[model samples]
Target chain A: MGTWLALVASLNGLAAGAFLLGAFGLLATRQMLGCVRFFRLQSLALVASIFLIAIGMRVPDLIAVALLDLAIKPLLIPWLLRRYVREELFRRREIDQLLNIPTSLVIGLTLTLTAYFLAGVLPPAAGAMGNINVPIGLAGLLLGAYTLAVRREAVPQLIGIFAIENGSLFAGIAIAPRLPLVAEMAFPFDMLIIALVIGILTRITHERVGTTRVGALATLREGAPK
Target chain B: MTLFVILALPLIAAIVSALPLGRKLAPSATLLAAVASVCLVGRAALTVAAGHRVVAVPDWVELDGLGALILLLVAVVGTTAALFSWGYIAREENSRHLRQYYANYNLFVFSMLAVPMLVEPALVWTAVELTTIFAIYLVAFDNTPEAVEAAWKYSILTIMGGAMALLGFIVLFHAMRFGNEPFTWAGLVKLAPKVSPEVLESAFLLILIGFGAKVGLVPLHTWLPDAHSQAPSPICALLSGVKTTVVLYVILRFVPILNASGRINVDRWAIIVGLISVGIAAFLILQVTDYKRLFAFSTVEHMGIILVAAGLGGAAAHYGAVYQILNHSLTKSFCFFAAGTTLLAVDTRQIADLRGLIRTSPIAGVALLFGGIAIAGAPPLAVFLSEFSIFRSGIAGQHYIAIGLLAIFIIVAFFGILHHLNSMVFGEPMPQATPMTPVHLPLSSVLTLILAGAPIVILGLYMPSFLHRILQTAAQGLAG
Candidate 1:
């Protein structure tokens, strides 16, 4: 490979690793702000990978997607959430998760490894430009799903979903860099709506239910549980 | 021209209804748009059913035999739900929340209509996700703690599923990118044979499991009963009736593509998931204490049957699948409307709480019982005809094991439904604790029921030859 191409590829590998690390950071974070911070950082890593892939592969549309990710994920979504959801919800509050940090990390690792195995099922032709991004991005995606499963707080669960979105786009840019820019542009707009809608929902849940501990929502269960 | 018109009507209604309008204005605007769209969709369906694909922009904006079927059902329900909402929401909710409800309702209908009209796969995914977002507000419109909680669970889980499905779509684009094909469903089927099976397999599984959560497939269906039951009854009609079918239609688009790819046992995947959903939801139906929840679980059961028929993989089976699609959407919506009326009369959702419904309000009691029987696949009903066709195809194909299990599950669900309906509709009058006083049923609500109920009864006895032709075309396209 040419030197410039090699450098981009290697830097993308670092971004992919940091991307997965951000997922792990989500699992490790205790505060709601910490979870959001990890999600922003994960999205940044995704943007980095997208940017590198855009320049290296000369796929012009991904550059736009990278900018959209940079603007939306790291900045706009959080700001929108803050504006809509009360400040108290984002206060340095610890989140109540289903599992402890250590156990969650172990499961996170297992999920990441499994994601690699899933990617390993593909022919080498599968990840033509994906290189390390495919497996690492899959790991990030799996870890994000894990984060969603374990997080009980509404905002943290929301962050977990964003993590999944970031992780998937992280893999997507490398795999389908040439997708139409219009389609790629729709992603940011879609995220804006998601943040707005979920932000409103979280606010409503907090106001009406007196808590955002949504996992305990058990009224509709069969047998009309006590 | 007509496609854009159909899409534009709901969007215009959404904006207009969201404005600070009088209470009647929002529902009126929404109902007008819905009824107008139904007329337009009827024309489109007829054209497509008569043998021409509807294409607005070749590969980008289009509809086909299968798309026409879905679009037609969504339009029909949108009209009835709009009418039903006119009475249900005005009577139950604060007048201040009325415009907001109608706005969200129109937007929800718009998103669903967009799903079948957009031929681009990624655009289709966006439309599907849009349905979830737009409907979240309506799901939580009750403003009760339980309602918000249901909306929260529904949105979070389904949005997660949508995210996962996003990855699936992205991977699918990568698979198709090199083939120089247009990324439409038709284009993908053509490209599938050349793509590596591993890539296609991963894409198929991702999309299936991702969309499956939204479709109320087993293991990801904890939210369906809660969300469907808690949403105001009109929204529940949309939720249980056509919403699940919309997402399932997206998943079914892949079955043929995977089959075209060759080497993947996609049928087994559908069958396994279908059977599990049917088996689990059948028992859940028996245990459900709430009448609305009983209908919700029945939705899951019917979805399983459709998926199984689609998986059975023959022209006849595919025909059964599409036929069930039509029957389920119409009858299930009617069931929810019935449940809504029953709620109107007795002011309780609990099956145990209702007694001597026929004496209290004959219209509601009769509608409830008829809806239950129809959805339970009683003979001479639309669901019964379609289900029997599925069994016929399965037996003809000699799939004895799957056919046997499906038959047993159907019977269990049928008895469970009848048991619940029987107790609620026809018991001795209770001591006058609350005196079983029936509220005055709304003219709009009664009229909505009548309008929606005709097809359930009529289609059972006889289907128009044109609809049969459309179903045949839809089946052929779905089964490849």
Candidate 2:
């Protein structure tokens, strides 16, 4: 029992470490592919955490959840991102981010601290698994939202959005390990479909207007100007 | 059984209608599928009215009075939209786009129906997200520059909201763990009192804002007008009429659980956001130039009113809100179909270019005039009756300030819509525009306009015993 508890704690620690690393990497990376690769790692860590929790809690059904995450998140999403990049922005690999890497990293760290502070403020619920997981998960969530706001490219924005999902999944696993297996299964499928739809929309935008910057999509308004 | 049929039939129709054989007979196939679903809805409504709830697959799918009310709305509007699509889309696109359009349209209806039917909270959120994905494709069906852009904006903004809502779901699911209850609506509501107050409060706020964004609440509604104006007219009718109501229903589903929390007054947040949306959209309506956009902003305003009604926190307010849902769905859809026919007749959506509409297309012009009046909450129309109930509930609940503010904004919106619509219907015809051949209105579209309008007039003046009973039950159910 002691060994199992230690193992669970260390596994959750590893998951939080991976999530924070990916979030900081999101701030540090200029290449769209690199950001997506970080998301893949974050999702992989989340899957590992889910497996650890399943093992610790003796709930075998979560194996399916881990497998679904592995199939959709680390494998399928990254593959789709690669294809989207090839199709939409053939020559461009780097995103011209709104904030420079060093400054954004500083802000990302501050967000992590803010997340810790915010999580500290919440009165702890009884059934939560570990103290560190919620705060770390929140850190990932905040960094992910910040990345979405700061990134200008479409693919990076998609990555940021996926990062938010990863954070929530991590928090959800730690806080509610007994969440219905069906609900857990549905999350990955929804994210997969959303990624595919975003890919299709990006492809269309690229082919028609030769740009995938969200800032460029400001033409529609109240009236057609004379 | 009936619940599953109401949910699954449209999805199956969407898939089957995507096939080559089905594409060739898309309109008839879609109409048949829609009619079949309406039959199922009628059956389910009967079940609910008999004081029996349908629980399909245990906790995953269920329908009670509130669900039944929304199901009936989706069925009626969906059938009309399908019929309107036949006449409105047939002449506008090629066979390939037509097939894709019908498929997406049906799938869109399926997702909306799934929201009100699903009992599991997570699955309900999934269905709501599915609605946006399916609808965004339909929004961009035209492949025009404006259409693509609008679809993209609609996708990103609403998905962002969906993601936040998912976060709330995660928190709520975590809270449910405290009592070892299932993560369904009934389970969560049953467990609400045991959950930590702090967690419940945060979850409620996150959810209200998250789904609130999709409901086109102010400051998150930049996508509403763009998507509405750029999409084909039939699709716009569904987006404004059925889609918004369905999302709001999802929001309302959480009301019982939030009420049970015993730690927070969630209605205040609803009232605040409701007031802002109504006030902002009402003022913004005066500045819109596109006729379709004008209708779209009116949707935003009406959504605000419904939210205010929901926020008022009384049995009567809940009743009024559900009744308003039905009224807005019928009247707004008729207005969009009328706008589509008007666009078809005149070949433009610009308000400035659509002068003397009565001279050009008398039926469509008259439809627009009356539909506009119905939407503006004029007397002896469906919206008027519902809005009156909302006001009475607000006064009774002592939400005097909110009611007063809502009254002012609603009147402003009323004149704003009436001014634009009246000019288009009654002003002199555009002198510079060339006289064109009179376009014949499709039989399906005429039926849609007449069918949608009939309920608005009839239900306003008289309510059947069964409907009144259902509304009362739904309102009571919503309150607890």
- The candidate that wins on TM-score is 1
Candidate 2 docking quality: incorrect, acceptable, medium or high: medium
lDDT of 1 by residue, B1-480 (tens): 899999999999989998885777888999999999999999898898888878899999998888999999999999999999888888745665888888899999999999988989889988999999999999998899989988998998899999998888888887775487898999988998898887788887888888999999999999999899999999999999999999999999988999999978899998889999999999999999999999999999999999999999888999999999999999999999999998888788888878878887889999999999999999999999999999999999998999999999999999999999899888875655144444788998899899989999899889999888878778877976
lDDT of 1 at A144: 85
Off by over 4 Å in 1: A122-129, B432-438
lDDT of candidate 2 at residue B202, scale 0 to 100: 78
Tell me the deviation in Å of residue B222 in model 1: 0.3
Provide the lDDT at B226 for model 2: 93
TM-score of predicted structure 2: 0.96
Q: Where is the poorest 10-residue window by lDDT in model 2 chain A?
A: A121-130
TM-score of B-chain for each predicted structure, in order:
0.98, 0.97
